[model samples]
Target: MLPPELPPLPALTHAESDLVDRFLEVLDLVGRINPARSSDTYGGLRAAQALVGRAAALRDALTLMHERGESSIHATTLARALRVLDGERRAARVTLPPAGES
Candidate 1:
């Protein structure tokens, strides 16, 4: 189910509506794909379709999850840590400066 924060489809921004529509398409495709097919050909097709559906969630989540700045900040923090580990602490700190300071 979609979060309550989501508004009506027509009112959604381009990215939001696209994700919502893609999610719905994946859901419908999942219904049509039979995961337990006896034939190898059919089984492969179903498995691929299932994997596609799974991937769609992450794709949709990319922008949807960043609806607010909290997750974006978390991402920045993680990226900074990764950069620090890679010996780019100065760059990371510059990219993600301390929250309050100019």
Candidate 2:
């Protein structure tokens, strides 16, 4: 079953709200396919890579929002979350077998 929608964050503009929603959706998928949490090895690795890509996309979106004068508070909070997801991506990469070793 799909998880419930997250409550809206404080002080977000309409455009920021949409970006946050997309970021959360990608994060939810990352959580589900996390290697430590899920037993499907190869699948987890693939999902981790996808997560990394999504997180990078989110970072770009957040940067654009900030450039367009979104609140610093919101930008900082989302940037922190993106960093956490990047850490997860790194850990997942470490768990994967070296290229040509699998």
Residue pairs with colliding backbones in model 2 are none
lDDT of 2 by residue, 1-102 (tens): 997665444555655665765676576667667554666778777777788778877787778878888746566755555454453454454454556754
Give each model a TM-score. Answer: 0.36, 0.51
- Please give, for residues 1-102, the per-residue lDDT of candidate 1 as tens digits: 864452222333444444444544454444334333223566557746676766667486655657743253343534433333332422232243456744
Q: Which ten residues in a row have the lowest lDDT in candidate 1?
A: 85-94
Cα RMSD, each candidate: 17.9, 8.3
Best by lDDT: 2
Badly placed stretches (over 4 Å) of model 1 are 1-9, 34-47, 50-54, 57-61, 64-102
What RMSD does model 2 have? 8.3
Give model 1 RMSD, 1 decimal. 17.9
How accurate locally, in lDDT, is each candidate?
A: 0.46, 0.63
